[model samples]
Target: MNWLNLEHLLLDESPDRLLCQDPDLTLGQLRRQALCAAAGLQARGIRHLAIHLEDAGELAIALLAAWRAGVSVLLPADLQAETRERWNPQVDLWLSEQPGDTRLGQLYDAEPLPAARLDLDQCSLSLCTSGSSGEPKRIDKRLRQLDNEVRGLEQLWGAELGNACMIGSVAAQHIYGLLFRVLWPLCAGRQWVRRQLPFPEDLQRASLDYPAFAWVASPALLKRMGDNLDWPALSKVRRVFSSGGALPADAALSLQQRLGQWPCEIFGSSETGGIAWRQGETLWQAFAGVQLTQDAEGALQVCSPYLAPGHAEQTADAARFEADGRFELLGRLDRIVKLEEKRISLPSLEQALVNHAWISEARLGVVRENRAYLGALVVLSESGLHALRNLGRRALTETLRKHLSNHCEALALPRRWRLLRQLPLSDQGKLPQALVETLLAAPRGKAPEVLEHKVQDDGLQIELQVPPDLACFTGHFPRTPVLPGVTQVDWALELGQRLLELPPRFAGMEVLKFQQLVRPGDRLTLTLRFDAARSKLHFAYHNQHQAPCSSGRIVLQDSATETAHA
Candidate 1:
């Protein structure tokens, strides 16, 4: 992982090593394509290039090509309009794997240029992350810093990884995935998958092909997995690496029971690099050469080779030291609030609530009515939902109140409560504070509640809880209030566009049928699949007992044409 010798990767690597699973690609072929693209970048006089490709192998090639051309790389986290508008001006060119984008393809067919050995500082990278103000904050990293991180990771886990091919859901734009998925395994001569396995079924499928592969996962993907998956097929997974957020205790334990190993949860940020990690343990042990201490305000202070030389950073995260040199995180300093002259720790409250058998996970935050009061967002276990069904909402609330009352003072008790099947985490597995506040302020009865959402490559599956006072059910009553047929069609289109990237111009509907009436308080699972070639969105709604409620095809006009006469 030496910065001076990076050119060896492009020019001198073994020819037979594989880089992709589906295509069964070779390292040499990828390197040649990158070298040609680098030449094109040089010829075009592009200096700062922004890369937002989806394929992992293409992303790696773009990065190397940029570096080889002496062009700085800007790895955008996403391709949203706001993100593009903010970073677009800072970059000289934008690259993506969209249809009709012939820049890279044209370059790959051009005469190849010799790979250039980048200077330790020439191959720089920039990325934007959200700051406290909710605005994007730009962070630049030197090649030296990234190289040191890969080396440190190798020194620690090389023996265990042991030439295993890397595969899983984590993407390459994030720091953790950049290090573990692309750079570390590649530099260590281990084959890496070009596409992400974003589902448990995909993981098991890859395990059958490459029996010795490591998993690069996130909390969101792991949390969505069920016991129905073929877990035994993944028992040969060499290692499991997770980041972006803390892995739930229950998920870790369940995974261990299913796969016979606990995932290695990493603890760090984009600014500080990887600080420490743990294996289903309450405490985190710092990585090699990463010095840790507590500031006067209890914030964790870090000094490591991953940072700029002779630089130290103090993070807002509060930490408590253990006798064995391991540390326990006590959440952020800003998460503590004073209520009735007594301090309340939000994370501590969540931890205590999750300890109860009925509650699987809990998130506590502050919301204001007249004054600030705690709001509890709890993910119920089977027993908790059973109690809720039998005793009703009021009794369920009182039951949780009595359990939490034993652990915290009266001032710290949540005034507002909401139960959910899962936390609404983003694709990157992050639940920000702003989202927490929004969820707390959101009112019921306006729309159906989303209990669980899992996005796939083609489409997504959503579990919706139909509220008794659903706005669409206001007057759609035939003795009993039922969800309107029109409402079901609308929900499919809305969720399809938001989640599945389906086209927006509604042409018409085809083969629409309502098999059963969807009544109030019914739980429904909606599945949406977008067919790009035919411009159709297929949707199906099923009940809790897997009974079909409705199914249809939503025909959409193409981007350049509209069905004006439809």
Candidate 2:
């Protein structure tokens, strides 16, 4: 229940024991490099450091160095500008691998400092959580809390894993990846892949090289594994750990059939750490020393050493405790909504949509306009695509909506629909709420495809083909498909600025006209001319027959100037 004695831990490990591969490093070498970097940070008087490194090896070194230097670490899940800006005040220095940034490699040649006792209670880490709205919420973590969880993991499965190395497809900035891929392995004296194995092919290759290894991954990656992969190489994997979200039953069974092992699914949030895990179609068993209970509303509440000290933390998930001390998760409690004074469950609506033979996946959300209305983003199955091609977008959408009416009230039916070939997922493999809202808010259409492109001295000329199935084409006409006039303006502005390097903020539009109808499948040539002196871009669209379709001038202001104007 105390902080890990990191100073002597790595120094006492076997000098030749493998820690990283591909420019391999041993435990002794890692400690020496980390100590050197710690000395450099001490020399620079960095007390609070923010780490943003992609390479796991480099990240591990920086983390250890900061710990050794008695400096608190800020581990941001993303390197987006907004995230960095929010944390800028709290951090004294940034440790990254970006060019021109302060990096650990700069201190590689510095004199190594003697191992110092680290006060685990004094060590701090800041992690960002992407809440339901996709905004980042900061969570402060103590090293002892993380150490307790890592020790619980080792006690649960460390014996069966033996000397198996660790490989992960997830970034270590997140809690799951940090514990399983970085901290757990280091504390257990197990080797881990130096870099993240982002792709399935990369995982297969690493499996072949390492005879035995534990795979740390997310449900998104697990669902993407198909029958085309090499099963033999996957069989060499000793264990598979999945987190980030719930794994579908079908995906779990598929992995079991192929890899001869069921992936251990971890159910927890960034705040709670690891609460429960399951290997197959059974109730989730709580981890050692973790207690689970239900609130008055049947929502799950967790009390564990892994969590911050206090009363049990209440979770959003509704669950029922089984007689065997395990729990079965019902859906999320927050997903239930009220529409037109009627209670409607978003997840239930999504389930109904997916249960229809045509829909492959569906997500339901309330879109706010003059009044709130339900919206659905759906991925069509093969049969659904055939239906869309045969019946058109309006008919297909109506059919799906009508199918949902069988089980739910009319008010609960989604009024707006966007059919996607595949749902948009973030790099972390989760559907970001902001992206979902953006997709629902934007006019549906296939992005224009470039048929031909030519760079001019001042601007560019390009020919594009507008596909018939573009979302913008839908509902414009029931029987005949025509591109929306507004979509044309959007395309012009988007392409003009993208290719011509126009100013970031839109100022106004001039001389805009929709003289001729642009139908789907029409080939149009777009010409853009930038007037930098006036901060304006002139654009014209003409059909293949040289008939003018549209022309406009868009004025923009530089981002800095626009900000000042606001």
Candidate 3:
């Protein structure tokens, strides 16, 4: 099951076949370069070498050369200086295409070196997780496991690849790109275009060179292609594959409409490798060797002998089975929300918001304690914003609030709404949760001033004042008498601090659920306790009932006062 053995078999048939983007290194020339690199490594007494390369044809050649030299290969995540410095291996020397330099890149022809035999069962390549949340960790795949992948892929698509050249956007250093662009092509006896397809320009260049090609790329790349480029119908392209992230339904349909064929969407992670592929609206058909089942929680569980043992990895993804024997992936099961004793799906909320005429994209997230507050960040289309500008900001917010209020209760309406210039799009158009938090951290415009009250030094006394004419009550529940929670809190806090110079800043309380709704006639008393050392203030609200209705702790700050004094 040695992958090299399969590669050798393929190479034997086309020693002169092209494997790189470079027109100079024809198939025969690349093989000769690999031999030379092998000899170079042997002469230097090197048994192990790590390759820091972009996804390209030279990288494949260098990898094959390392195998031919009987040297272990390490592929780092990126070529940061620190990454290069951390290349600790069993061997002391390194093999690179950068001749005078030590960096590993696509190879050029060199004199042939002695051939070193490889152990098919041994480790062949090392990959690292993306580590978006933590440090990247390395995972080693055996030559045999990789061989199984190439064999599986060849059996499924080898005939199509026979005449098509490999072309992909993802870097070969990652698992998806490596297997699709290198191993599969070599195993299938297919020629590969040698270069990482980076920009639209690069893809255009490749189209000029290789009329017939197979593109392997991520959903991010495809989404961007839809947004920015008007791609020609890929008449010469045999197939294209997409992976790395969820393929948006709209993006998939639009891409097919433009390209004349839909790219295959792959569902799997690095831990499990390729699992299944979905095209158009079809349910995902499992790859040839992969088996799928469900756990007790109804999550998709994959059992692959080729995967690392000790556990049958069950994914958080929800799925459904079709009578046709295919499986369809639903969204993640972890995205459920419970509010006001009613369970809600954020995705459903987002769908509802985006259904509005003005909104282009939307996401809803719960932020307050006990998930009491739900906030929305919306990206408005140009026409949407223009329409809103005519109504003014306050009118826009009020309009949206009233719109939601009509269908949902006051609590269900987003506590705060902002018109964002753009959606927090990832390299792909998908909104990441982390970026949502960043948007929420920005300062909201301002809370409108309601009423002011003054209290004495003891913090035990209070003064109550009402606005001569209430502006908030103008339309708020016109038929019913009600006070806005925001205005109510502002009035209560202003009056409680009059005499008690207990720090210019005070706390606000929202913990008490309003069991009985407060109306315009309700007289409310609010009290506070300030602890100097802790720089903390606690507030308690009292109305008709003796026991306080709500209490909360707030951290008080005087940075503005100190700055003024300075």
Residue 59, model 2: Cα distance from true site in angstroms: 1.3
Report the error of model 3 at residue 264, Å. Answer: 1.1
Alpha-carbon TM-score of each model against the true structure:
0.79, 0.77, 0.63
**Poorly placed runs, candidate 2 (over 4 Å):** 1-10, 108-110, 132-134, 389-392, 448-469, 472-566
Using TM-score as the measure, the top candidate is 1
Candidate 1 error regions (>4 Å): 1-7, 98-103, 130-134, 337-343, 406-409, 445-566
**Across residues 346-456, which tens digit of lDDT does each residue of candidate 2 receive?**
777787888888887788887888988889998777687667655677888888888999979888888888776556554356776556767788876658977678998
lDDT by residue for model 3 over 1-566, one digit each (tens)?
A: 11335435314445655555555555566666677766666666667777766536567667777777677787776656666565554336544444554644323334576444445566466676655323556767667667777777777776765567778777777778888887777656566766667555566567656757787876656655634443663556787788877665656787787778888887776667778888886589988878888877678888775476545767767788987769876656566667878766666566566656666666676766555777788766545565453444455557666766655667767766656544544331245565565556565422222223454463443423222114454455544434566665555455435434556654334354443444432445566666668765556656555445545555555768557767
Looking at candidate 1, the ten consecutive residues that score lowest on lDDT are 1-10
Question: Candidate 3 overall Cα lDDT vs. reference?
Answer: 0.62
| Tens digits of lDDT, candidate 1, 160-225 | 988688886977887878888888877787778777777777776776787588888899888877
CA-RMSD of model 2: 8.4
Which of 2 and 3 is the better model by lDDT?
Answer: 2
Error of 2 at 106 (Å): 2.3
